[model samples]
Target: MESNLKWLRSCDLLIQNAYVFESALCRFVQKDVAVKDGLIVDVDKALALDSQKTLDGSGKYLIPGLVDIHMHIESSMTWPGAFYKQALRWGTTTLVADPHEIANVAGLEGIHEMISNALSLDIFFGIPSSVPSTREDLETTGGILDEGEVSELLKDPHMRCLGEVMNFNDLKQEDSKTRRLIQLCKQMRPDFLIEGHCPKLTGQDLSIYLAAGVDADHTHQTPASILEKAAKGMFLEIQDKSVTLENVQTLVTHALYDHFCFVTDDCMADKLYAKGHLNEVVKKAMAYGMPQTQAIYCATYTPARRMHLDDRGMIAPGKKADLVLLRDIASWQIEAVFKDGKPIASYPIPEASFSLSLYHSIHLDPLTEEIFQLHGYQGKAVQANVMVIEPHSTFTHRVIESIPIINGQIAYEKVGLNLVMVFERYGKNGQHAFGFVRNALQSSAALATSWAHDHHNLMVMGNDAKKMCKIANQVIACQGGYGIVDDHGQAMVHLPVGGIISDGPLAVTASELEEVTRRMRQAGYVHDHPIMSFATLSLPVSPELKITDAGLIDCRRQQIIPCIERVLTDEDND
Candidate 1:
C-alpha cells in the first residue's frame, strides 16, 4: 500500500491487521489505523509505517469508542468521576449527560459543579429544560430553572443541547413556558439539539410535540411508535427497556438503522456495576437478531451523529483517535480502550469535590406516625382514588375503591392497599400528603427514600404507619438516601450528596444499592429495579397517576386530583 513517509513518521500509534469498523459504510473491513497527535491520520490496508508504538490487532475487532447520547450522571447515585470510571471500563469513551437531577436540586450551580468535575471525561452537558419536570402548582422542587436560567445556561460552552423536554403537557399550550424555552434554544444555539421525553404520546399530541422543534425521544418505545416516529423524521433513542425483540425486529425489518441509536437513560449503580453500560444495550440488540455491524453502528456512529459530535464516531482521517479494541465480538469483551491515541490506563481517574450545601440538601421538620394517617373522612366507608403500580413498569394505573374508615382514618389494609406519603423536604412549606398504592409491598414493612424523582422530595410507603414514620425519620436523620425497615431489622444507604448521590466510591455505592434491593425484595417490593422504580413514583410528568407534596396528580390531565373520590354512605357501603 502507498504511504506518506512524513505523515507516517509523525504517527504516534498504529494497530495492524484488524477488522476495522468503517462507520460511514456501516461495515467492517480488514485495515490498519494510524494515529498521530491524538487524531487518526490514516486508515488503509497494510500501512508499512514504522512509528513510536504499534500493536498487533490480528483477529480483533476495532470500532470507534461507544457514545452514550442521553443519560443522567446522578441516576447512578454517584458523582460524575465515579460514574465515568465504571463506564470507561466497558468501552464508553464519550457521554452526553443531562444533569437535570442535580439541576432540579441546585439549578445552574449544580450543573456547573458537575461540568467542572467532569473535565477529564469527554462528557457534554445539556441545559436542563425541565428542572422541576412539571409546573410549580403540580409539585415542589428544591430549584427552578426559569427562562432566565435557561438563557444564562445556554451561554456556557459546555451546554450542548436543551436537556430532555419532560413537560410534554405544557408543550401543547401555544404560549407556555416550555415552548418559549424551545424557541430560546433555537434563537441562542440554532445548531444545538433538543431532546424529548414524551412517553406513550401519540397522534396529534406527538405531532404537536415534534412541531415545537424537539427532535429526539428516549422514552419507552414500541414497534408501532418506532415506525411512526421514524417516519415523521424523529430520532429514536432506544434504552434498555425499549430493547425488545419486537422493537429490534421493527428497526431491522424496516432498515431504520440510521434513524435510531442506543442509550442508557437511567441505569442504577448496581446495574452499571453488575451488568454493564451501553455495551449491554448493544449486546441485547444483537441477541435480538440485529446484525452485529448494525448494532455497533447504532451505539457509535448514529449516536455521535445525532448529537452532532462528528469528530470521533468513526475510524477515519482527521477524526479524534477515540477507539475500542474488542477481543471477542460475540460476547462484546473489550480488551482495551483508547482516548486521543493513548490507552485509558495512562490516564488517572478524576475525583470530585462537593460543597457543604450539597451534602446537606435534605431539610425538613421531624415526622410522627400521625403524618402517615389519612384524616378528614366523615363516613364509615369512603371511595378513594388509589395509585396502582403496574407490574414491571414505572407507569401507575388509577383505581377508585371503597374502604372503611375508623376514627376518621381510612382503613387502607381492609381494601388491600398500602399507605404512600410524600413530604416537602426542601423546608419550603412543610407540606405533606397521603395516598394509597395497591400491589406494592406484600409484607409488613416500610421504605423511605429522599431520591424521589425530579422533585427529590421525601417519599415513604408501607402498610404499617409506625414503620413508615420510622423509616422516613431515619432517611431525614441521615439527610439523604434510602431507609428500609421490616420485621427482621433496618438498613440504610447514605446518599449525602444533594440527598440523591453518595459521596463515596462507585463500588461502595453499588454494593449498598444491591443490599438495599435485597432488603426491598425481602419486604415484597417487587420490581425489576426497586430503587429507581420507587424513586420515579413521585415523577408527575410520567403518566396516569403520581403523587407529590401537593397532592395526587392525574398526569394525563395535568391537575391535582383528590385522593378520596367521594364518601360512601352506609347504604352505598352495603
Candidate 2:
C-alpha cells in the first residue's frame, strides 16, 4: 500500500470474497471492491491493496443498496428513525419519502418536522405536491401547500422530486393550484421525478397525466394499464398489492423491466418488519418468473435513476459504498448491509424530538353516539349511495343501496352493513360526515382510526353505535391514534405524532398492531387490515368512489353527492 498512489488504493475499507452486481442489469462477476472515505475507489485489482478495515463477503452476492423511490413514511405508522432501523436491516439504504400525510395537517412545517426527525438516516423527500390532495373544500385539512409554500420547500436539497400528483382530472381541466405547483417543480427539478396516483387512467387521460410531467404512478394496476403506461414512457411503481404473478410476467417477458421499480408505498410497521421491505418485492417478482438479477435492478438502479440519485445505486468505482450482501440471490437472505462503506450495526432505534404543537395533533370537540346515527328525512325508503369495499383492495365501489327508514332513523343494524363516520379532527370546522359502508366487515365490529389518508381525520365504522362511540372516543383519548372496541373491551395503539405515526420502537408498534389485528379478528371483524378499511375510507384519490370529511365523493365526478336519493311524498313533505 502506497500513500501517494494515483488511485488512492490505500482505502478506508475493502470488501473481498464476493461476486458483485455491477449495474442495474445486475450482472454478477468476481470482484474485489475498494472503498476510500465512504466512496468506492476501485472495483478490480484492489485485491492486493491494504486497507484500514475489511469485510469478507464470504459466500454472499453483493447488490446495490435498495432504494424505495416512492413511499409515505407515515403510512408505516412508525417514526422515520424506527423505519430506518427495520428497512436498513432488510437491505434498504435509501428512501425517497413523501411526508404528505403530515404535511396535510401542518403544511411546510410538517415536512420540515419529518426532515428534522430523519436527520440521521438516508432519507430524501418528494415535496408534497398535493397536500390537501384535491379540493380542500371537500376535505378539512389543517394546512395548505399552495405554490408559494411548495416553491419554498423545493429550495431544500432533500426535495428530490415532487410528491404524488393526485388530482389527475385537474391536469385536463387546466385549472386550480396544482397546475402552478407542477410547473414550479418542473422548473425546479426538470429531470427529477413527479410521482402520480392515477389508477384506471388510460389512453387520452393517461397521456394527459404524463404530459403534465408526472412521470410515474404507484396506484394499483392491471396488465393492460401497466403495458400502456410503460409504452407511453412512464415508469411503473409497483407495490405489494399491484405485483401479481401475471403483471410481473408481462413486465419481465416484454423486456419492460427497466421501466419498472419496486416500492413499499404505504406499508404498516408489522408488514415492514414481518415481511422484508424492497426485498419482499424482489422475491415476489422472482416467484413470478422474473429473473433474480432483473428484480434487483428494479429495486436499486431504476428507482435511483427515477429519483435522480445516480451516485449511489451501483457498486462501481467512484460510487457511494452503500451496498447489500445476500447469502444467495435466490433465497434473498440479507447477510449484512453497509452504508457509507460501514457495515450496519444493530442498535436501539432513535427517538424523534418534535415541537410542542406536534405532541397533541388531534383537536376536536367531544362527540356523542348520536353523531353516528343516519336517517332518511321523514322516515321514507330512499335510494342511497353506499360505499362498497372490494375484497383486498382500497378502491371503493359506489353502489345505489336501498335503505328502508324505520321509525325516525335509517340504521344499519343489518349484518353486512356498517355505519361509516368521519369527523374533522383538525378542528378546522365542527363539520362531520356520515354514510353507510356495506360489506366492509363480516362480524359487525367497531374500529376507529385517526389515520385517514392525506387528511388524518377521525373515522369510526361498525354496526354498533355504542361500540363505534367507544372506539372513536378511545382513539381521541389516546390524543390521536387507532382504536377497536369489541367483546375484548378496547384496544388502542397510540400514535401521538400527527395521529398517524406511532412514536415508539418499530418492534413495539408492530407487535401492538399485530395484537390489535388479532383481537379485532377474534372479535369477528373480518377484513384484511380492518384499520385500513377505515383509514382509507376518506382518501380522495383512490379509484371508484371514496368518502371525505365533506361527504361521499363520486370520485370520478370529483364532487360530493347525496348518499341516499330522498323520495318525498306530499303528505310527508307537509
Candidate 3:
C-alpha cells in the first residue's frame, strides 16, 4: 500500500466539510475527505493542500454509498451493468445479489455469467444455495447446482455469501438437499454469510432455521417477529412490504439500528427508476420516525458488516471511495454519485450478451387454447381448492370454492374466477398443471412470464383461454420474459435469456415494464405490481397456496394438493 503522507494533496478528488457519516462517532460530522486511486486516504482536514479536483459539500449530506446486502438483479429485469448503473444515481454504490433466478435456468454457467458481469462493478454475489429450490416432484428447473457447483463457486473471491436458502421446510428433515448445501458451505467458509427466505416462521420453526446456520432473513414478518428474530441473533433484511410505520416505530424506539439493514430484495426495473432503489428504503424509514443518520446507517454500514465486507462501507482511510452526495437528506434526493473515486454519468447501458445455451432456454412444447381448458368429471358441480391472491403480498391464501360444472367442463364464464396454469418450461419432464385463481386478473386479461420465482417455469393466468395461450406462446417465442394482454391489446417484454432478466438497456426495459403495468391497471387489475403478480405465482416458498409446474402446493405442508376436488358418484352417495 502506498503511504498516505507521501502523496501530494493535489493528487485526486477532494470532498470538503460535508456531513460525513462517522461509524466511530456514531453520527455525522463536518469533515474533509480525500480520495486517491479509488480509495479514501485521509479524513478530518486532509485537503488543506491544493487539489486536482474538488466538490464542496455545502448543505449536502455526504454519505458512504448505500450498500444493498441482499437483492436480485434479475428482479430488476436487467443485467448487472444496467442495474448497477441505474441504481448508482439513486445513491446505491455496492450490491450483494443472489443469482438463483438464472441459476435455476442455467446452473453453473448462469452463475458464472452473473459473476463475471458483477465483477466489472461494485457487485458481489451470494452463491445460490438452493438451485431448483425444492425437489423435482414439486417444481422443475432447467438447471441444478449440486456440491460440485457450490465448491467451484466458493473459490471465486466475489462469492461472499451463500444465497437465500428457500428450502425452509426441508431443514429439519434428515436427507434434505438443502442441508447438504448448507453443510458444504460451512465446510468451505465457516464465516460466510448464509441468507434466508423464511416468511412467517416462528417459535420452534424459527429455532430450527437458526440451528441450521441461517444467519439472515429477508422475508415478511410482523414488527414483533422482526424484533424476535433480531433478538435471536439473526440479522433482518427488511424489504418494502414489511416496512410499515408501525414496524419502523418498534425498531426506532429500540434503536437496534446496527442489527438490521434496508434491502430491496426484489425490485422491478420500472419501480426502481420511478421511486429509487435502496434510497427509497432510507426515505421511508425516515418517514417512520427514524433519524436521518440512523436511517442512513442502516442503509450503509449495517448491511456491509453483515456481509463481512470491510473494504468499502465507510469513508475512513483504506476504504474504497464509494460515495453518494445528497442534495437533501430528508427526501433522500441524490445530487451526485462516485464509484472508485470517479463520477458516474447517466447513459444507456448496452444489452448484455450470452452463450447459445442461455439464448435457447425455452424447452416448452407448443401450447394452444385447448391446453388451458379445465376438464370436469361426471358431476353437475364440485368443490375446488383455489389459490387466492392477496394484494401486495407474495403469500397466497388457500380457499375452497364450490364450482358449478357445465357441459362436462369447468365454467370459464364465472364472475370472479380466472384460469391459472404452470408449464414446466425447463424441458425437465414436459409436464403441465391447471388450477383456479380467484380475485386477480378480474376479466378480459392475461399475463404470462418465465420469470416465475424459483423455478423459472411458465406461469400464466387469465379469464380468456385464447388470450392466455397467446401470452404463453409469446413467452415461448422469446424463450423467457413477460407477456400481457388486456383490452388495450397485447404487449411483450422479451427477456430471451432464462426469462428472468434481459441483456437490454435498463432504460428501455423499465419503459416497457412501465407500459405493462399501465396496461394491467387499465384492465382493472388491482395488484400493487403486475410483475410481482407474475413472479410470485410459482414460488412455493411463499406462504399458503402456491402453484408449481407439478400442481398447486400447500406451502405450509410442503406437499402438492388437488386444485380441483372430485365429486362423489350417486352410487357412493347412496
- Scored by lDDT, model 1 comes in at 0.88
Each prediction's whole-model lDDT (CA): 0.88, 0.81, 0.83
User: What are the clashing pairs of model 3?
Assistant: 351-503
Q: What tens-digit string does per-residue lDDT give for candidate 1 at 149-200?
A: 9988889877778999988878888999899999998998899789999888
lDDT of 3 by residue, 1-574 (tens): 3554558445488898788889755688888888888888888854685667988987777889999988998888888988888898898989999899899889999988887776667788989988777777888888889888999999888988899988877778877778888888889888877889888788888888998989689887688888889888888988887788988988888888888899999888987877799988888888888888888888888888888888877879899889988888888777788888888773334346677788888888779888887764677666788888877876679888777667777784474788888888767788888788776776598989888888988989898888999989988988888889877788877797677788877778888888887877777677876668757878887788888889988888889998767663444441
Residue-pair clash count for candidate 3: 1
Models ranked on lDDT: 1, 3, 2
lDDT of 1 at 125: 85
**Which one is best on TM-score?**
1
Worst 10 contiguous positions by lDDT, candidate 1: 1-10
Give the TM-score of each candidate. Answer: 0.97, 0.95, 0.96
Please list all clashing residue pairs in model 2, or write none if there are none: 383-565, 384-564, 385-563
Q: Which candidate has the top score in lDDT?
A: 1
Error of 1 at 56 (Å): 1.3
RMSD of each: 1.9, 2.5, 2.2
Model 2 TM-score (2 dp): 0.95
